[model samples]
Target: MYRTSAMKQYQTVNIQAQTSGASPHRLIQMLMEGGLSRLAQARGAMERGQIALKGELIGKAIGIVGGLRDGLDLEKGGELATNLDGLYEYMVNRLMQANLKNDAAALDEVSDLLRTVKSGWDGISQ
Candidate 1:
């Protein structure tokens, strides 16, 4: 179904609720989930030739990736943090190209990278 106003409103409320109760680890998980979702949506929009929507979704995905990068603890996380920062930057760059070129393959590549990162994150004992 098409996104209705109510759907958007509900999503906002739901995210607020999740964030309020979530721990830092859970929040990271949510960000990964959101990034993946946006990439998929953006890809669909590209396939459908919805250029504007694709741009909007890709922008949101980039922001989410940037947020994740910003949240890294460089001092405490050390080399892992540095590596992740590089990966996030690469993802953001690829997303920009995907948006400009409407390349679904680039979107898929980013999505795969996110999934790999998310899997590593999910393995941590929380």
Candidate 2:
């Protein structure tokens, strides 16, 4: 348990360090990736019947999706940003549903959406 805690702490610091030096574009990409990862973990927790863990993971994922939505500069980004904001909002709603019902399908749906968005984010030449 101590070893696991130590490893988690190390990873947290590493991610923090990476974020500290990252550009805004990279930060968005990181958030998308984190959301996807959390969704996957939430699914695993559901499968294991770890209800609380699943809820916690899904909540974290929803927060990440919210962050993505909040980061959108709708004023300057125009139609595309508006569309993405809507999509992110949808993702957050679905995440909440997944948490409430322990629904793996909902998790899959959000994972797919996030992946599509992240793919587009990745394609942009930053």
Candidate 3:
């Protein structure tokens, strides 16, 4: 399960699970209501390799629907596993960068991505 805590600067959200699991569709709905456009912009950056983790370029971004429904264990679809991993890492990097830069806009982009993924998971559950 994911938990959220209020912080002085920003809210701290943590996903706790033995393995990474897919999110629910309602997450997508929430994202659409929040800022889907920003998510698209961030996605563009990802495609352009603008987003990096540990200074390494992200090569791909996978959008597999409910791929991780079983658990954190990865179930590859096509050739997207590696790219999805990179994208996930890149988002983590973006989150850190946004926090350090005090960029609310950047953080919003990441939030939207999370919501989309969660929504995909929700679809899987159904």
* Candidate with maximal lDDT: 1
Q: What TM-score, over all chains together, does every model reach?
A: 0.86, 0.85, 0.40
- Candidate 2 regions off by >4 Å? 1-20
- Predicted candidate 2 versus true structure: per-residue lDDT over 45-118, tens digit per residue: 99999999998788777777776776679999999999998998788778778888778999999999899989
lDDT (Cα, tens digit) per residue for candidate 3, span 1-126: 111111110111113211234244443333233333444554456445564431221111112112221123346443455554555555656655653454556556666676766566456644
Model 3 residue 16 CA deviation (Å) reads 8.2
The C-alpha lDDT values of all candidates are 0.84, 0.79, 0.39
RMSD to truth, every model? 6.2, 6.7, 11.5
Where model 1 places Cα greater than 4 Å from the true spot, the runs are: 1-20
**lDDT winner, 2 or 3:** 2
Best-performing candidate as measured by TM-score: 1
* Candidate 2 backbone clash number: 0
**What value of lDDT does candidate 3 attain over all alpha carbons?**
0.39
Task: Tell me the number of clashing residue pairs for each predicted model.
Answer: 0, 0, 4
Q: Would you list the clashing residue pairs of candidate 3?
A: 20-72, 23-118, 24-122, 25-122
Return the candidate ranking by TM-score, descending.
1, 2, 3
> Could you tell which candidate, 1 or 3, scores higher by lDDT?
1
